[model samples]
Target: MPREYRMMTEAPPPLEITDLTTTFVSRNRRTEVVRGVSFTVRRGETMMLLGESGSGKSVTARSIMRLYGPSAEIGGSVKLLGRELLDLAEPQLRAIRGAQIALVPQDPTGALDPLRRIGSQLTEVLAAHGVERVRGAARRRAEELLALVGIPDPKRVADSYPHELSGGMRQRAVIAIAVSCDPQVLIADEPTTALDVTVQAQILELIAELQQRLGMAVLMVTHDVGVAAEFGGRVGVMYAGKLVEEGPARQVLSSPRHPYTAGLLDSLPTPGIARGALRSIVGSPPSVGAFPLGCAFAARCPHARRSCGEADPPLVAVGADRVAACPVVNTEAAVA
Candidate 1:
């Protein structure tokens, strides 16, 4: 296993989230999108929040960054290198947003300003964060950043507008902006959603390489199991706003302790599995604020019991460095 794949035992992780929750308050109703999700990302390690759409993985990532507006109520703790972020004032957060912490948003085209040149955008971030002050110096550093992210012709790409670059190049430019100040933590939410397979692989590889070199912790939110496997660090399986299971990527994916995790793996297309023979989970995930009283996944779980529907299951120890919120699986494991 690569060093990045192993859990770092550092005293203070680069990022630590505890019992995080996000609730959207509208005129008539409140929707809790993220419910008590928690995890830690050690330096130089990638912690993947893997789940299907509407599973709240992306919401959880945003909660860590405190990205929601006043209508969204965020709770619990988000600590970057032991500093609490939830209570930080807007100015304080503004100082940290792109310097100590950065985000590679899902849509790179939307992330970059269309009217501005890519080089100008990069220089803007550099100047805003005080990384470079002089106009010429900032422009040169922006070009260096473009080159750092593997753009072959940094000068040309920097000079081009957002619409002028290819999708892959745009995504690379977004990453360059994100890492311009050498943040301690990088949050990549669905970084490969709209990219081609080849570009997706390249982006993932570039992020991994950058993580290894910069010693930065990565929080990667994606619905693709392949991305989780490729990153190969820690994996947290989320469903209906809660973490259903979490463990080392290889262990959880290979020997899933939660039925939802198993269902996701089974749905993948492998060489041994025939064409059009995927085994999908029975029901769709529940919408926010409409979750059942008990286990959110009980309705679709194969091993659900009468008690499973009575209350929300708490995450329990399933093995070394692993936890799952499923009593049936825990009971079976204990018996075995």
Candidate 2:
């Protein structure tokens, strides 16, 4: 049967974050990394959080899973399945992490245990999450999971250790483990970052196939606009811990309202451009916790004016299903 034709019932979305903030503290000094980042991922829908490094995209994902350790301070609400997760007890959060919300990390080599075989690792996850009671049941379930993620030979792949498998295979194994317990939400944080271009495309296709099969909301984070465009979903452009622009992926790519977003799109490599003539965003990204009080992108934004430095622009509706945080662009749109 065709993947698109796969039947999936409507499942309630699990994630609804609001004013979520994550701060790291050391020696009494605090660095606010993710400041009031808000977004939603509905069932069977993908939400790509697009940004450059240090733009608080990864931190926001970690905060959603409560991965920040004892040193960090988290504020605001992270409601999963209509329940507030910000203040949940450790055990409660533990129950939710793998069983309800699964994460496919960037580096599969780092994510997988070198000392353990892939089969054992996945079996352990299944047993730990209470998906399977007996060892035999867990092992069988692990093999089924490996095959579910499109591994050619599930048994052989499962028997091998992380080092024995190729990079793409390792990623597939990681994903298989993530979905073993059938999570409602899958948080894929740059899952294809380390793979070659061909493998990246394959892995992304596998993810899409699995998302449709399982009917789980996917929150994918990436630095590439091309990836976001290809992924084909709603996109949230993050800069300096805030969503600068957000809308349908095609709309955002075709007509970017925010200068920062336009800069990112302009920076994509195009075949029409001459060799060595690739456009690049000017200036460096602001350091964490040191961003200016107003618009964080003002220093680097070409269209920035005096008022851009004076006050931060709120994310306002620019069109149907679109919003951007840019007074300059907004005013230009209003006039034109």
Candidate 3:
């Protein structure tokens, strides 16, 4: 069947999150990287978290997996299948880590050991999870997974070391290992960052295909809106560690409500738009420890007013399944 046809047929339940926060602490200071972020990902649904660098997209993913450093502090509730995850112990969390929620980190090569063969690494994952009884069974399962991810000559590729494979192949291998246990949620953190454009598309296609076949929820963290639009059923735009806008992918793309979101969309290079016509969000992302008093983007936002500088706007529902944390969008819509 065609890819588009398959996607249209598959739908999943929503994954609910509420008031999630992650904080990093040093010897003398503490900083919150993810500030009261909330959203949902239905079973088998793809939700893209879009943001610029240092926007806490990856940190939010890490917090969900409980992979933060020891000094970090986590708050709020993260529920899967209606069970609270924040209170789970380390060992309990491990049980859910791969079997319930798998992660495909940004760098495939860095994720794998250079000294170990691809097959061995996957086998270890299987063994750790008790997914396979013996080495032979694990090896066969690993080959099957490699094939599932569209890697050619799966057995041969499995026997090769991480250093021997191309960038795209290595990423596929990482993904295969991640899904070896068929987890319910797959967190892909910039899964195609290092690949060329063609390879990137292939990887995205593979992910979309696998999500459909496995019926798993996907939390995709990306800085590229185009990538988000390609795979995400919903998109959440984050700025300075907060989710500023979220809605259906098409709605968010076609008519972004938040000024920050508009600025981001404006920055995208288009064939019709003049070469230098793109407008960028001015100023760097605020340091996590030194976020502005009211709106994080207010300093650079053209629509900023006295009210914006006085109180942080809450994420208000603007449309069915659409929310924007912007006073301007909210006030304008209210007036209309």
Candidate 4:
């Protein structure tokens, strides 16, 4: 059997999130962010959560790792290889974090401690995760991780603090830390947002290469359509904390079945398009806890009708291995 087929058939997926919901409570008020989101990422596969900022993409990713403090709330299931993470005690969760499931945060500078050297930080993760029991072995493994991430002169870079490295270098260090223990699942949230075009491409390529080499199930969260297009596995387009469209990345990004998805693709800067002629989605996304009565995107969607505001549209099959929550498109598809 092909590797992909066998990975799916032989065992459970590395990550499975079903009906995931996230809410925040402050001063006796509640605001929900992610709502009933569901997806599974198999071994060696990539699943992208794409949306405009504040569409709850980051919240969904962070919720999987249960990174929130006491003020936040989480519901639904987050499972890794059939082990539920949402209900796991902190001690047990600690064992899985960094060792089984790891996250590459958006801001590399913020993610890394300013006071710590890169090598020490890497070694610390190894020690905490019990990947290297000995002090010397842990230090050596830290350098090896740096080298694995394409950092030349790993020893020198490892000795340097985060501020001493360039943005791209720091990002590479973060990726190295995320993969140091060979995690079964990896969550990279906007990994290339702060870099220049050249560095961005390099970082993305490094991530893709590492995913292939390590056979990790990756959940890459980003707002860039180009990024989604490049990471061609599956894509979930989120809006107002709900997944509006999902399918094979090529299908969802190339020929969208949702108005929001179509509008997003249309807004991109294509070659030869004049700067002022770029199309844009007119309205702003709704804030959490302030969504419209029914379909959250209906107000901004061109094809929206009165009925669209009457009830939340369920994600229905629009194509092979695809689902979308747009009544107008679904109706048109049915008629056609």
The most accurate candidate by lDDT is: 1
- Per-candidate local distance difference test: 0.93, 0.90, 0.90, 0.93
Model 2 agreement with the true structure over 1-336: per-residue lDDT tens digits: 665555444333588888889999899699999888878788888999999999999999989999977778999888887778888899899988999999999999999999999999998888887889698878888899999999999999988999999999999999998999899899999998978999999999999999999988999999988889999989999999989998999999899999989999888778899888878889999999988878999999888899888888888899998989998988888999
Which tens-of-lDDT digit does each residue in 241-333 have in candidate 4? Answer: 999999999989888999999999999999999989999998899978888888999878889899999999989899899999997988887
Give the per-residue lDDT digits (tens) of candidate 1, residues 1-336.
667656464367789999999999999999999999889999998999999999999999988888886888999999999899998998999999999999999999999999999999999899899999899999999999999999999999999999999999999999999999999999999999899999999999999999988999999999999999989999999999999999999999999999999999999999988888889899778877899999999999999999989999999889999999998888898899
Global CA lDDT computed for model 1: 0.93
List ranges where model 4 is wrong by over 4 Å. 1-9
Candidate 2 overall lDDT versus native? 0.90
After superposition, candidate 3 runs with Cα above 4 Å error: 1-14, 334-336
lDDT tens digits by residue: candidate 3, 231-287? 859999999889999999999998988998899888989888887787787877888
Better of 1 and 3 by TM-score: 1
Q: Please give the range of 10 consecutive residues that has the lowest summed lDDT in model 3.
A: 8-17
Clash pairs (backbone) in predicted model 3: 12-43, 13-42, 13-43, 14-42, 15-41, 15-42
How close is each model in CA RMSD to the real structure? 3.9, 4.8, 5.3, 2.6
* lDDT: worst 10-residue window of model 4: 4-13
Pairing residues by index, what is the TM-score of model 2?
Answer: 0.95
